[model samples]
Target chain A: MIRPGSTLGILGGGQLGRMMAMAAADLGLRTHIYAPERNSPAFDVAAEHTVAAYEDEAALVRFAKAVDVVTYEFENVPAATAAILGAHAPLAPNAHALAVSQDRLMEKTFVAELGIATAPFAAVAGETDLVGALERIGRPAVLKTRRFGYDGKGQVMIRPDTDPAEAFAAIGRAPAILEGFVPFEREVSVVAARTAAGAFAAYDLCANEHRHHILATTRIPAGVSRGTEEAAFEIARSIAEALDYVGVLAVELFLLTGEDGERLVVNEIAPRVHNSGHWTLGGAVTSQFEQHVRAICGWPLGATGRLGRVEMQNLIGDDAHAWEQVLAEPGAHLHLYGKAEARPGRKMGHVTRVYPESD
Target chain B: MIRPGSTLGILGGGQLGRMMAMAAADLGLRTHIYAPERNSPAFDVAAEHTVAAYEDEAALVRFAKAVDVVTYEFENVPAATAAILGAHAPLAPNAHALAVSQDRLMEKTFVAELGIATAPFAAVAGETDLVGALERIGRPAVLKTRRFGYDGKGQVMIRPDTDPAEAFAAIGRAPAILEGFVPFEREVSVVAARTAAGAFAAYDLCANEHRHHILATTRIPAGVSRGTEEAAFEIARSIAEALDYVGVLAVELFLLTGEDGERLVVNEIAPRVHNSGHWTLGGAVTSQFEQHVRAICGWPLGATGRLGRVEMQNLIGDDAHAWEQVLAEPGAHLHLYGKAEARPGRKMGHVTRVYPESD
Candidate 1:
């Protein structure tokens, strides 16, 4: 097991990696951030950094040999890269979890095999398969590329007037999944951590709202029935156990109210820390970042107890300019990602506000 | 005023400076740490670092020119070093605050001049002055060097059988102050912050317990009378106003009970974040580290509200080896400073537990 003062190698250099590095430092662990980007924000806070492309096998081998263990911030870690690192060091949330999470068809098939509820989906490799899948899944379906899709990218909404050929061409004729759309009452997610010994802990269910296909806000104690909340946790537990997952993972779900009251349909899974879990940083007894570090190090899971009624709001585009005003407001915890540019629709920072629970 | 994205220059490279760097990063500010020792812990978290002697004028000038503002983690910052940095960059808590805080005689006299209640003290520069001061202060007094003392260092107690000359010799016959020690029930402190605009916010009074003159545990809502708690805060506010202090400062106090109930006597002042305030990191609305960053940057101070009944325990020496066990504890929030050695009496980390306040 990796002990305190050991080095933790993190593979991706974004805000999530930056947060994980900070959490590792808090636990007395040194961090080495390896990223392709020259100005990755995580590099600023890490103890050491390597600026190299992911495909640099020589650098990757050296990085893996230098650290006690390896972890990544994003799910799209190429299978070849994971294979190379795994040969040199232990990679938590292991290569199996990475492969399953990276492909939409595989992820959905895995969930279905476990008897978990997911949106009806079918693989589409050609124009004929697209029409066949649509006929099987019905109208108002989402045609998404099997790999490298995020924040509504590499996906197209299929309507009654939409042509199947046009939709396939729009996505560059890539291998895709046609998912039958469900009119969800709300979007919610469960961010949980699992230890190698099979211990699992989940934070409270949180309701999420998106704007322009980007997550805008996340509120905990999601306004859902107790049964739905418990079911959400069970789904997360089963997924973690099946994947033999170590470290943090997020499962986004769609809350649907049908004749059976309230039910949930699995939307997708992020094999690393998710933006929706940022609220746990200051709103829970143990933050998701810290929990991830503990799990990946083969340490025990921490308490996922929520502190209060918490709401997290993302600062998108030029919204970060109001940081000064946000700081002036009482009880608002502001966190900025240190990105120099405020490009349109880009995430600059976030603010978390926690209020007392009603008596 | 140093804005978000501006660089913050920090003096000292201990745990306090490391935590301050983390907090500054949370607010989107870059940090440049300068310390005399190479491989200082703070260097791992800061964006930039300088390893040079504090007396190196050329290096100090270069450091000052590279950052927007400067702040120190310890009161022992040399007068010449402070002047050199102050000449180039704006220093928070200013040079005068540093000079007064570094010298015990000046700190006591400054507090007393403001009509505040501090332990009775007199400067003793020589044997003649020591004899006179000892006679006036009576027995059970402490004779300490006027500058550069901490963790019970550089002080000698003058008991009934103690020889005045011997006590003077124990401190190397340096300039000192004789203070009449108060027979108190408990040690308490007020950790607060102030802005350049004169705005102030104070956390709840915390009672402290020490083992071998090193802080062992700190509990908030110090079991003192409400009146005494308010008075302690008043003392801190008055001191901050007098010094025009623009950062987090801690005021240690002795709770004394006589025939007229209870009162407080200021023991000393820490011009930077205090060890006793470590509980704020996980137990308050805003942590002392974050508070210090906000103050020094000329930004608005965050909420100083306590979250619960909190207790913070220091992990000294080999106690840090239990980090894994601590991580397993359901509600314990463990924070380990990235120190390599677990030397006797060294502060390796701390664990904070916060329980809901009883109505």
Candidate 2:
């Protein structure tokens, strides 16, 4: 088992990686960030860093050999990169979890096979396949590229007046999946962790809101039934067990409220820490980032109890400029990612406010 | 004003500096740690580090010039070193605070002159002066070197039978002070912050217990009456205003319970973050380290509301070996400094447990 003094190698150097490195350091572990970008945010806080492309086998081998275990901040790690690192050192969540989550089609199919609910989806490899898939999925379906899609990018909407061929062409006719639209009541997520020893812990369900195709706010006590919350936990546990996951994973779901009752449909799976889980940093007894480090280190999963009724709002782009005002507010916790540019749609920082349950 | 992306240069690289660096990063500020030690713990989490003697003027100048503002983790920063850095950058808790805190005689005199309560003390420069101090302060007094004393070092307890000349010789006959010990009921401290704009905030007073003269545990609800608590804050504020202090400063005091009522007597003043403030990291709405960063950067001070009933224990030497057990305990927050060895009396880590007020 990895001990406290062991070094952890992280694959991505974004905010997620930055938080993971801080968590690792809190547990007395040194971190080595390996990312291709020169000003990767995680590099500033880590003990060691290697600026090299993910496909560079020599750098990957040396990085893996330097640290006791490896983990990643993003789910789209190339399968070959995972294999190379796994051969040299243990990789948390394993390569199979990455492969399943990297593709939209595989993730839906895997969830469906496990008796979980997901939107009706069909693979479309060619223009003809789009026609057949569109006929079954119906109008208002989304044609999304099977891989490398994030934040509403690489996807096109197919409404009644829109052409299926045009939507497919918009995504460059890449291997894609057409998913039937789910008009749900709310979007919620379960951020959980699992260890190789089969221990599982899940934080309270949190409802999410989106703006301009980016996460805007996340609030705890998702306002769902206790039964619905339990079901969410079960879905996350089953998915984690099926992948033999050994780190934190977030499963986003659409909570549909129909005339009969409430139902949850799996939206997507993030193999690593998710932006929606940022609330847990100070709102829960154990933060999701620290929980990920504990699981990957083969340590006990920390308590997932909520500290209070929590609301977290993302400071996207220029929103972070109001940090001085936020800092002046009493009891508001502000966190900023050390990015120089505040480009539109870029996540600059976040603010969290936790109130007593009664309030 | 120092912005979020600016670098904060810290003078010492111990655990206090390590925690401060992490807190600074949380606010989007990068950190540069300067310490003489080869393996200073803070170096692991900082963006930059300079390993050179504090007396090295060139290194000090370069370190100060590299960052927007400068702060230190320890109170014993040499006056010359502070002057050199102050010329290059803005130093929080300025050189005067360091000079007053570096020597016991000056600290006591400063506190006494501010109309605050302190033990009776006299300067002892030679053996003859030691005899005069002993006669004036009485037999059961403490002979402490004016400079460079920590964790029970550089001080000797004098009993009625102890020879005055022998006590003075034991301390190397350096510039010293003889203080008449106070028979106190308990030891408590006020951990507070002051911004350059003169904004002040103080956490709830906490009672402390020490083992072998090193802090062992600190508990909230010091059990002193409301009036006593307010008096403690007043004392801290007066000291900060007198020194024109910026950043976190801790005032240690003795609670003497007499037939009349509860009274507070000043013991010593720490110009930087103190061990008594570690509990605030997770037990309070805002941590002392983060408050220090905000204050020194010309930002508003954070709220100091207590989250709940909190208890903090230091893991000294082998106490850290039980880290696994501590991690397994739900809701126990463990923080380990990245130190390679656990030498006797060396602070290795700490654990904090916060309970709901109702509990």
Candidate 3:
């Protein structure tokens, strides 16, 4: 068993990895970060770091062997890398999860097969497939690449007048998935964790807002009915169980309101910590970062009790320039990733404001 | 000005430095920990680290020049080291504060000169000085070395009929001070932060329990009268202002109950974060670590609001073997130092528990 003094190897040296390393340190676990970037934010906090490409088999094996267990900050970890790591040490959330979440076609299929509600999606392998899928899925649909897509990248919208060929061309016709747009009244997510022993816990459903297809703000006590919140938890639980997941996961969902009342459909599945869950750092009894560490460490999960009404806003690009003002605001917890440069849409840091429940 | 992305250099590499580096990381500040030990705990979380002796002036100058501001984790930092760092980069809680705190006699004299109540004390340099000071201070006193004493080391208690020469010999007759012991109801501490800008904030008075001269437990709300609590804060503020101090400082005081009600006498002052303040990590709106970083950065002080009734217990030595049980306990925040071995009386870790105010 990996005890407090044992080392944990984390792949992907981004803000998520940085926060994860700090959390692991809090629990007395040493962290070794593996990333190809020299100034990776995670490297600053980890006890050890390997600046090697993910495809470097020798480096991957060395990193895995050096730590008692291995985890990752991003779900885009390649299948072969997971296999190499798994061969050396325990990999949390499993290789199967990476395979499923790495491809939109596989993720939608997995969720649909598990009887979970997801957007109507059809695989589009080429221009011919895109034309056929767009016909069936209808206009005003999203044509997204099956793999290697994030932050509004590798995806384009197809409207009624827009050419299907142009849409496919826009995405470079890369094994796409055409998902019919759902008129979601609100975007919310269930961030939860599951252990190998089948134990599971979920944070309260959170309402999320996106700006320019990038996560902007997340508020707890998502303005959904109690029944809808419970249903969201159920959806997350089913997904975790199907993946046999260990560590924190996020399931983004669309809350559709119609004559039939409120309904939830899975929009996306993040096999690692999600941006929406950042509020838990100061708003929840056990931060999601710490929760993920505990789960992957095979320790008892901490209480997911919310401390108060909370809101977390990501400081994207120039947004972080307001750090001074935010720091001056009392009760506002600010977290910066220690990134040297702040390019447009880059997540430089985040600010979380927590108010008494009465507020 | 030291801004969010600025690098902060720390003078020590123990657990206090480890926690401070983590805090600095949280606020977007990078930390470079300078310590002599190879496997210092602070290095695990710091952005950079240098293993060099305190007397290595070249290394100190290089470290100072590499960072925007410098603070330390312990008070016993050599005056020359502080001067070197300050000459290169801004150093908080100036060298004078360090010089006074590094010596028992200087600290008492400084506090006494500021009109603060302290145990009756007299300087002892030799056998003649010890005997004469013993006569002036009376029996039942503590003889502590003027420098480099901690955790009950370098001190011997003088009881009635005890030979003063033996007591002096026991301490190697080093430059020392004889302090008349005060019969106190309890020991409490005031952990506060002060900025060079003259802003000050103090957490609630915390009653501390010592085992083997080491802090074993700290319970906040000290159970002292409102007046005594305010008085304690006043004493801490006066000391900070007198030193033109910056960063977090702890004032250990003896709480005595008598016909005049509760009274506080200064026992010692730590120029950096103290163990008794660890409870603030989870029990206050802003932790002492973050507060220290903020103050030293010349930022606005944060709210010192307490969350509730809080208790923190140090996991000393083999006591950390209960990590499993502690992890299983709900609402308990466990913090472990990444030390490989847990020697006797070593602070291996700590667990903080916060209950509803009513509790």
Candidate 4:
């Protein structure tokens, strides 16, 4: 088991990695951030950093050998990279979890196989497959590249007027999955953690809002029924247990309200801390970042109790320029990622507001 | 004015500096730590670090030039070191605050001059001065070196039978002070902050307990009367205003309960983030460390509302070895300074437990 003084090696160097490094430091652990970017924000707060690409086998081997254990901020860690690191040190959430979550088709298949509800999806390996899948799933489906898709990128919405061949060509003819639109009433997620010893813990369900395919805000008490919330957690626990996951993972679910009652469909699984969980930073007894560190270190999980009614809004791009105003507001907690450029759609920081639960 | 993304130069790379650096980074600021020790705990978290003596003029100038502003974690920053840094960059709390707090005689006189209650004190520069001061202050006093005394070092107890001369020699006959000890009921502190605009905010008064001359635990509500708490805040405000202080300052006070009422006597001032305020890390709406950064950067002070009934316990030496047990305790927040060894009496970590306030 990794002790408090052991070194924790992180794979990515973005805001998530930065927060994780800070959490690890709070537990008296040293951090070594490994990223390909020269000016990765995580490097500023880490004790050590290596600016090397994930594909660089020599650098990856050296990094693995230097730390007691390794974890990544992003789920799309290359299988070869995970293999190399796992050979040298423990790589958690484990390689299987990454492989399962990396591809949309595989992720959906895995969820469906667990007797959980998931959006109807089919593999589209070629143009013929796209047409065949489209005929079966109908129009208004989203054709997404099976791998390396994020933030509304690498995907196209198929409409009645849109040509299947044109849509396939738009995505560079990559292997893809066509998901039938679920028309969800609300987008909610479960951010949870599991230890190697099978100890599982989940935060309260949070409702998420997205703008331009980017997550904008997350609010707790997702306003779902108690049974629906429990169902979501069970889905997450089962998925984690299936993968033998040993870190924080997030499951985004669509809440569909019908004539009967509320229903939930699994959208996707993030094999790492998700932006939707940012509310836990100050709104819960234990933050998701800290929980991740504890689980990966083979330690006991912490309390998942909520502190108050919470809302977390992302400070995107130029929105961060209003930080002075935000700082002036009483009881508003502001967190900014140290990124110099304010390119539109880029995440610059975030603000979390927690109100006392009214009696 | 210094802004987020600006580099904050910090001196004395101890746990206080480490926490301050982490808080600064949360606000999007980078930190550069300068300390004489190569393995200083703060070095692990800062963006840049210089392992050079505080008296190294060239290194001090370089560090000052490399950052937007300068602050120190300890009160005993040498006059020359402050001067050099001030010439190159703005120094928060200013040099006068440091000079006054560094010497016991000056600190007591300053408080007394402000029409505040203080222990009866007399300056003792030599053997004759010590005898004269002892005669005036009476026995059962504390004879302490005027400067560089901390953690019960450079101070001796003067009992009725104890020889004043012998006590002076035991303190190395350094420039000293003789203070008539007060029979106080409890030790309390006001951890507050002041901005350049003269805006000030104070956390709730906290009662502290010490073991072997080191802080052991701090609890909020202080068990003091409302009037006494107000008086402590007034005392702290007067001192901060008098010094033109900008940044966090902790005023240690003694709360005395008498037949008439409760009275407060000023003990000393710490012109930096203090151990007594550690409870605020998770116990208050905004932590003392974050408040210090805001004050120094010419930003508005954050809210200081208490989250609950809070208690912070320091883990000294081998006490930190029980971290696994603490982690297992739900809702307990643990913070460990990245210290390798558990040497006797050294602060290794801390645990904070916050209970919801009863209606």
| lDDT for model 2 | 0.95
Residue-level lDDT tens digits of model 4 in B59-99? 99999999999999999999999999999999998999999
* Clash-forming residue pairs, model 2: none
How many backbone overlaps does candidate 2 show? 0
* Each candidate's DockQ: 0.84, 0.89, 0.83, 0.89
Clashing residue pairs found in predicted model 1: none
lDDT string for model 2 (A161-202, tens) is 998778888999899999999998999999999999999999
> Which DockQ-derived CAPRI band holds candidate 3?
high
TM-score of each: 0.99, 0.99, 0.99, 0.99
What TM-score does chain A of each model score against the native chain A?
0.99, 0.99, 0.99, 0.99
> What is the lDDT for A328 in model 1?
92
What is the clash count of model 3? 0
Distance (Å) between predicted and true CA of A229, model 2?
Answer: 0.6
Predicted candidate 4 versus true structure: per-residue lDDT over A222-334, tens digit per residue: 88899999999999999999999999999999999999899989999999998999999888999999999999999999999998999999999999999999999999999
User: How well does candidate 2 score on lDDT at residue B126?
Assistant: 89
Candidate 3 chain B least-lDDT 10 residues: B1-10
lDDT of 3: 0.93
Q: Global lDDT of each model?
A: 0.93, 0.95, 0.93, 0.95
Question: What docking tier does model 2 reach?
Answer: high
